[model samples]
Target: MTADNALPDCVALRIGLAARALPDTTPAELVRVLIAVLGQPLTEAKLNTLKVKDLKTGANGALSEIDDMAALRQALQCLHGEDDTAAQAAVPTPQPDAEGRLPNSIQVACASNSGERLDGHFGSCARFLIYQVSATEARLVAVRPAPATTRLSIDHSAERVKLIDDCDLLCVLSIGGPAAARVVNSGIHPFKRSQPEDVALLLGDLQTMLAGKPPPWLAKRLGRATGERPPQPSEVAS
Candidate 1:
């Protein structure tokens, strides 16, 4: 986008959002850096060619303001159209009961990067996907966005844990010992998966376990007596 001519509304919107996503980057500054990298009108083609390294270039290290890689990636996503807008549309809505709770269900938080997938690592994911799961049903109750923070920091890990403090379980591709300890101390059990998978499938497995014979540790949460896999909380749809 040139200085004399105003940007198109669509382009302006995206650029404004992108600027905000990067820490300390103003629309003017982002435009300046972008112009330096891509030159002239900032079309999608030009934006696509822009790389993370390019963001760090410019006079006096102008783009050096972006120190947080997570936020930097987030800003790039805005220009790349990989942020929340498209994903949020596809995210499932909460299906809590009249009392605003999923009866006989436990809240599970999945570390997510893009959409409704358990693809992100603890303390680094873009968001925590909160799901309310019962024996026969699993519904998306909330999608909590994680604060942009430097990875592996004790302080930021606590902040992330607080985001899903209400959840019973936390699922992720991986979690570090310290972060996992924080999660456990917060009364949220951490479950690690070796690879990325649909959040639904993970909840589905939990649902099946709930529907049948759940493990002793898990059964206790449902208020079931030892050796009794009660499906009392399983309320069928009317």
Candidate 2:
């Protein structure tokens, strides 16, 4: 079979294991939850664009360790429980600090460059995407391309960094440490891993990060709608 046709089975298997382990949740629910956790919307556009390379590259390491159905089931249970505990532990308690306010809106952007010989280090050109997040939801608003000149631009990078710095939450993918460091220095933590599905997972975290509590926004959004507060900084850091 074509590798693409094989991906759904792989994705389903990964998610199903997590589901069987977390009997409280179903494989379908977990996939939906994970799609949100990874900050990916469950939509036809996304699913249509889903690539085997993306799935295998991001999940191959995890998948390789699953030797059999029993092993997979055990691993899923462990992971599901871990997720549950982590969610519960992240519940935010009330506090009085302007610092804890949830963002009203978020914008994300991506950029790539033709210069700087990024291919030498990464064996390809660098692709940069940034997400700006708020309380209700987050959006991918900007993409920065590499500079056209031989040397990189301090001014351009600085500009992009500033935009990301202003965000209450920022998600970055594929940009190297030096570029990521710019945002990290601004107090926004950067997740080094970047895959379409992984991005979806991180997006889920952004919702929880804003909610300041156990059970991320995606769960709450799916479970019910109420006045639950997102978790606090300490809760998020843990």
Candidate 3:
């Protein structure tokens, strides 16, 4: 049996969303997982009741459904009627000041396949989502697609760097060592994350750091002279 009769497109759409959320999972594999966990033809009501723990405990794959909690939550949320496309559309922006900047804000670039998510790798992300973030606010300033090419190679790293050169930082799930070197050489700090998450959530964490005694790297990014900030507690003598 198929999802044709279930929840008026709910099962199918939710499946697509869940699959998208777990970038590492193919729809066929997810369907198998659903079949095992939810039994036979999945329904919207059944999908709605899906939980992160269910997948984590029931499914096994490259991501293992255990390692990527952020992804699991997103997938479950998608199944639970949380619309990622709608969330992407609802991502709001903060108005910039006359100078086209937010107060004490810095430009940040996120590698993403989806519109406002930090779910893509540096070398292969479809687009870059640029945001202006300060202690109090964050704004989605631009969405720049990668320069189209016949094929992607290390040489394209420089092109990608130039694409977001105006940004202060670049965050991605993965980046080649050479590409990271190039990014640093271009004055853009490259941050590598272990998992994909919402761009807004990532920016919110940055905002919180900005409101406190930020770390050396962050303080440097915020224009504080390197020597002016105190060392992290862990760095001090035992």
Candidate 4:
């Protein structure tokens, strides 16, 4: 469902204000706010599929079932306070190595709706399949689930970008301009594919790239892995 359809007018207004007030708020934090406001535990899968109307319907439905308006109001106030505290807290940024080369065994994050294919868009994936790759091998590292809802705000995009901040590359079917910019700013390269591909096939291709002389980006990453200096700007340009 779209963001516009997912929430009631009042609920949407409240969330919009909170989001605007806290421009750096995380997607997980927004999910918590929705949970509090809606009075229900919404799953990431369900939230992913909801449009704005759907969100509104869900919020209205939940409110209709609740007989205690005071209780609901109190719960929302508590949640808003928690969000404020979280927004004000400092978040540590990841630093590049002394040599400024990408790591040897690079971490790559693939956007997938299911676990098997690289089909999801960068901004709206159901999950991210992470892999640790070296010149000779690739291994599955972790699977990060998407938040319950996609807010599509810059703050939400920043939060999602942070989720894979450790990674060197992001593979997805498509990515919006804003989302792509955020990913690059976080020091992750965004790779877009025209169609979904098998995860194994993609990994095999990556292994080949690593085994051979990689492109500029991968070369730099390989330099980090092997303790060699990355190519200078002039060298890369040549």
**What TM-score would each prediction reach against the true structure?**
0.56, 0.31, 0.55, 0.54
Worst 10 residues of 1 by lDDT: 229-238
Q: Which candidate is the best by TM-score?
A: 1
Between candidates 1 and 4, the one scoring higher on TM-score is 1
Off by over 4 Å in 2: 1-132, 140-149, 152-160, 173-178, 194-201, 212-238
**Total backbone clashes of candidate 3, pairs 3 or more residues apart or in separate chains:** 0
- Of the two candidates 1 and 2, the one with more favorable TM-score, higher being better, is 1
lDDT of 4 by residue, 1-238 (tens): 3443355433433343233222223233455546644444344333333333322234344324334444344334423443334223322222333544334677888876554677566655556888777767666667776543334433556667888887777888777677777777666778778767877788888889988888888777556446587423222211
RMSD of 4: 13.0
lDDT of every predicted structure (CA atoms): 0.69, 0.37, 0.68, 0.56
- In the predicted model 1, the residue pairs found to clash are none
Candidate 4: regions farther than 4 A off: 1-103, 150-154, 225-238
Candidate 2 lDDT by residue in tens digits, 141-208: 44443221111112334555565454433433244455555655654444433333334456666566
Question: Per-residue alpha-carbon lDDT of model 1 for 3-75, expressed as tens digits?
Answer: 7566665555556556545543445567777777778776766776666778887544697856879768877
Name the weakest run of 10 consecutive residues (lDDT summed) in model 2. Answer: 116-125
Error of 3 at 206 (Å): 0.2
